[model samples]
Target: MAKRASRRSAAEDPSWACPCGTGLPYADCCGPVHRGEGTAGTAEALMRSRFSAFAVGDTDYLLRSWHSSTRPARLRLDPGQRWIRLEIVATERGGLFDSTGTVAFRAHYREAGRPGTLDEHSRFVREDGRWVYLDAQPD
Candidate 1:
């Protein structure tokens, strides 16, 4: 419902490396999705973009990328937490033509000077022909 409002924009620099660990520049990777210039082509791309969003503090993009069914009314990100990297473990059925998919990933971060990782097997679906995060799946 509400539009994206990023807290930072280091990714707005085309030369900056994308936080998604894709070895691509931010502009070439998730920046477009964050900037509303394009949409993710696959579930994996959406997952990566969401990771990038966290790194850049783009809560707007995160909420926008969420499926309406699971989207929260409000989001509060930890200012003390810094997202460090994203590692996609695997994926299933979320190709360009697929209607739904699942992505397993580990998102590394630092919070209050402590390092941690959030590992999740996430579900995604094509809603109105666009990829949106649904929810975390049971292990």
Candidate 2:
């Protein structure tokens, strides 16, 4: 079997801001999470990290942060699709004290030079002491 590629740090530039809209440097925000040096402290944080993963093509991070029941064996990112921005719309109960939560957001992207957006309300759960993505609520 071929060895899966590990997630590389998206923070190649020390001064780049995090794609998660945290207003923090990539190294201070999602980069540590992507690098396995830390974990997201809340469901919202997990959601943000996952979005950053998509933006940076960190498939391993995406898989690790996904709940096993809903996690796929592999993830493929479209190189043609460039994630540009994220707009958080709402969050429900996915706090430090809560075991589960939901986040609604709009992810802006560009594909083949055309712009688009994906709006979703994602569910998250705390499993084995970490927040992991569960599923997206059906529209």
Candidate 3:
């Protein structure tokens, strides 16, 4: 986990705006979807905003972005954790109008004295003209 986090920090977009920003306020952007007010436009966009939510401890947004079919009944973030970085490896658009989409990425974080990574190939679906996160598969 240490190695993975180091590599990502060394070789990725270090200054990206997190869709939510650094002050922990997401209301203008990712906050809406995180609050279940709206949905994202693309799989990658949703994924990025979700990462932003994690960085700021917005579990509500995480669940809201999740597809109804796959969204967990309860969601929580470790109180001792902090997200360190996000790396979007690949993304596919224009795949299907209402069927499928994917975003492959790795999220690095530190928790309870340990550094860890969450790597996933996430699926998305478009419903009612908005894109929502479906689920994640091992990379």
Candidate 4:
């Protein structure tokens, strides 16, 4: 059977801050992107939304935003794992005008009663006029 999209509503509390460390409320930030109501304007914004998608178990959004060449046939999120925070270390040319860019980030998570961090430098490219995740490189 195909995996069903998550049922959790993306219309989170309007006052709740977005999980992407953007300080803005979910409704004003990544929420719109996740809902398909809007598109991220830059690679960094897309990267931030992807992180938020993981945090909320939005696998559908993750797959949709991933570049087709690298996108997997299926995505599985560990129910025992909880993504806690994101720290963007750096970005290169992922602005509104760049066709390609990179973002270095550390994602902190806790799973199986242990804490860990995933450090990666991810690449993004414009696909059909939208930014999509291509792959990751060692940080």
Candidate 5:
């Protein structure tokens, strides 16, 4: 036989803090969610993971976590935009037992060396027992 493969998988770098600003290492936070090892347990958890996904440019996770009713056919993240920070403004329901929730947040980024912020109130609901992004509420 040619060389046998090692059973150990490449571990995520533990030095990097999670992009969601949770103060936890990436591997112990969004890394597992991105790897499909687990899902967000609550709507707020899902929101945090989604923000981290944008920072890391994981379009697949963004689409997958989106509600089918509102998910777009495709998504294109801007390569020049670097997501730098996330500030959760508030949360409505979307807890461990609730089926629906809303997350109000501000996502800060820098594009072409210019800083900007996006504020939105996102809707979320349980789809087949999993929390998924529904849409944004009208301001």
Candidate 6:
């Protein structure tokens, strides 16, 4: 028989501190979108918040922030999963009026008693004056 595996939840995972090292929770810092209280105003800000949302398994926020042009109809979360760490490699901006941006990041997580990593360069575009996730590039 296979060894038993312990399930993990979001609360059991390590909490991410603000980029500022203020020791603040991500949900408290950039969790609100309707309140217009998010600190992520630029492309990078949006990217960070999205990553944080993923860490917390905030699928609704992720879907809401995604661009309609490329956003999928639904997002699924795997049970017994928890994100480990996030590493943003690079970010670049297009022209002011272009309203397009890119972010390269590596996201590591654990699920189903296994560890996994996802590295991608994601594309983002500003539509209707809001930044939205477009797609991811293969490594």
Question: Which model scores highest in lDDT?
Answer: 1
lDDT of each: 0.91, 0.90, 0.67, 0.89, 0.88, 0.67
Candidate 2 residues lying further than 4 Å off, grouped into runs, are 1-10
Candidate 5: the clashing residue pairs are: none
- Give a tens-digit lDDT track for model 1, residues 32-82: 888899999999999999998988889899999999999999988888888
Tens-digit lDDT track for model 6 on 24-121? 65445554542356535667667777766666666877888888878889999775666667677888883355589888877788888899988889
Per-residue lDDT of 1-139 in model 2, one digit per residue for the tens? 9774332443556787888898998888999999999999898999999998998888999999999999999999997897878999999999999999999999999999999999999999999999999999997
In candidate 5, what are the lDDT values of residues 1-139, reduced to their tens digit? 7774321122256777888889997789988998889989999899999998888888999999999988999999988897888999999999999999999999999999999999999999999999999999999
Estimate the TM-score of every prediction. Answer: 0.92, 0.92, 0.69, 0.90, 0.90, 0.73
Error of 2 at 121 (Å): 0.4
RMSD of each: 5.4, 5.3, 8.2, 4.9, 6.4, 5.6
The digit string of per-residue lDDT tens for model 3 on 62-91 reads 776777888899987776787877887888
- Can you tell me which runs of candidate 1 are displaced by over 4 Å? 1-7
TM-score of 6: 0.73
Residues 11-128, model 4: lDDT tens digits? 3768877889999988899899999999998888998999998988899999999999999999999988878789999999988999999999999999998999999999999999
- In candidate 4, position 23 carries an lDDT of 94
Indicate the TM-score of model 3. Answer: 0.69
Of 2 and 5, the candidate ahead on TM-score is 2
Checking candidate 2 for backbone clashes, the offending pairs are none
Q: Which stretches of candidate 4 lie over 4 Å from their true place?
A: 1-11
